[model samples]
Target: MKVSTHTCPVCGFDQLKEAPRSKSGSASFEICPACGFQFGVSDDDDGLTYDEWREDWITRGMEWSSRGIKTPRGWKPEALLKSVLKKKK
Candidate 1:
């Protein structure tokens, strides 16, 4: 059987690791070590390019954070939005 390699769509990193399987034996996700991007079901079938992923990721992240979900690195939604906007400027 031929082995298939997975790459991070966001950072183009080939070093991807599989995440732990869910209890329900559902779909699995791959995590990119280089950029810490987790590729899930939506990402696989969303037909989003890297640029679109970046934009959508940030937007969804902010939306989740706004709902009181703790974001990575202790960043608030507003703070993360500011940082991204600053980089675009």
Candidate 2:
């Protein structure tokens, strides 16, 4: 009965086919196509918490971080963040 949430915890990009982490909270090592956050590498090795990366991403203008992946048409990072925050509360 554990529902897997595929939503990216960093920028609220919800199209992730598989969650970055498993149900037991293990990193999948899959890189997010939106924020380019490689789950285990960025977190375990680089020692970045989600909040820290999120702040840096915002400061960097929230640009689509994935290389060679086209930004989705009409994608709005601000709106994505808003929607995700609303769900969190």
Candidate 3:
């Protein structure tokens, strides 16, 4: 949900709203009011074109969804973060 009103490259439409993200923490869809173009946020984060942004989004998504589903990818990232954040008792 952390998004700015940026122009959609696909539709040359500047008006965009932050659509709800999926369980994977990726934007489920974007709607262009001018052209009625719809596209997913992942379509914008490919490594070849936007590697830095992709990494940034991934980090944010992981953090935001930490309390939600434990993605099928694995629990290592969440576990690692929890361990790192855990206080010594």
Candidate 4:
């Protein structure tokens, strides 16, 4: 049997890792260690582009924040770096 691998579109990295399966059994995501980009295992199933995905992810966080959920202070720097790099695109 042949094995398939997913590549990162942002940095052209071939070392993609599979994310844990969700309870819904929806399509799985492949994460790029180099650029921290994630997408569905199959392109056809992944309707959102990188930016779209990021926006949705951010919106989810915002929703949680609105509910008074607190985020860790240490994560702020990494989130800022990701945002800055995203704007460079």
Candidate 5:
């Protein structure tokens, strides 16, 4: 698969301007619009593993997470999730 820098490592939403983690291993602190995973806050502060969050998000019905941002037309989370990097972290 062609990995993208803009892709969300957990949820495969590919619209981000930057990767979740930087080369220096700093979390971007950006919250994903698709799955609501805050790169730093969710992972570091909350102690929530990426895979655990993804699994729970999937179990709870994949819904658009961003409140201010409108969901894209024809949003299909399961389909987009196919591009997400699996539980490697």
Candidate 6:
């Protein structure tokens, strides 16, 4: 068994203590306690993991909902245009 330790990027504190291996040996990630930050380590260009992105998006959505915030009309239009372009590809 190999022990993996991750230090918080923000606070430089070693708070999270876990070793999580991804499916198909894709990547690994750890959480930080001092700043509640999470990061992923992978043998690829993108440093973020799927879990990190999902969690971040979910958290952002929850925060936005709590604040009664709505996505801007301009942003929605841009997204719709991008979606149409992607579908056409």
Backbone Cα, N, C clashes tallied per candidate: 0, 0, 0, 0, 0, 0
| Local distance difference test, candidate 3 | 0.40
Local error of candidate 6 at residue 46 (angstroms)? 10
Cα lDDT of model 1 by residue, 1-89, tens digit:
95555544454443334432345645356544433444554455565444675566555552331223233454344543454445555
- The alpha-carbon deviation from the true structure for residue 57 of candidate 6, after best TM-score superposition, in angstroms, is 17
lDDT by residue for model 4 (20-44), tens: 2345655456554444444554233
For model 6, residues 1-89, the per-residue Cα lDDT tens digits are 96656433323333236533445644345544332334453214456643454355445542211123343333332333244335446
* Displacement of the residue 77 alpha carbon in candidate 5, Å: 0.6
Tell me the TM-score of model 5.
0.86
TM-score of every candidate: 0.31, 0.85, 0.29, 0.34, 0.86, 0.25
Model 3: how large is the Cα RMSD against the reference?
16.1
Please, what are the lDDT tens digits per residue for candidate 5 over residues 1-89? Answer: 95555878778888886789999999999999999999999999999997899999999898899998999998889877876654343
Candidate 6 stretches greater than 4 Å from native:
1-6, 18-27, 41-89
Query: With candidate 4 superimposed using the best TM-score fit, by how many Å does residue 66's alpha carbon deviate from the native?
Result: 21
Model 5: residues with Cα > 4 Å off, grouped in runs = 1-5, 85-89
Worst 10 residues of 2 by lDDT: 2-11
The lDDT-based order of candidates, best leading, equals: 5, 2, 1, 4, 3, 6
Judged by whole-model lDDT over C-alpha atoms, candidate 4 comes out at 0.44
TM-score of 3: 0.29
User: How do the residues 1-80 of candidate 2 rate in per-residue lDDT, one tens digit apiece?
Assistant: 96555878888997777778888989889787777888989999999988788888889998898877788999999998
TM-score-better candidate, 2 vs 6: 2
Ranking by TM-score: 5, 2, 4, 1, 3, 6
Q: Return whichever of 3 and 6 wins on lDDT.
A: 3
Instruction: Report lDDT (CA) for all predictions.
Output: 0.45, 0.84, 0.40, 0.44, 0.86, 0.39
TM-score of candidate 2 to 2 decimals: 0.85
Among all windows of 10 consecutive residues in model 1, the one with the lowest summed lDDT is: 62-71
Superposed by TM-score, candidate 6 places the C-alpha of residue 72 at a distance from the truth, in angstroms, of 41
Model 3 CA deviation exceeding 4 Å by range:
1-3, 19-25, 41-89
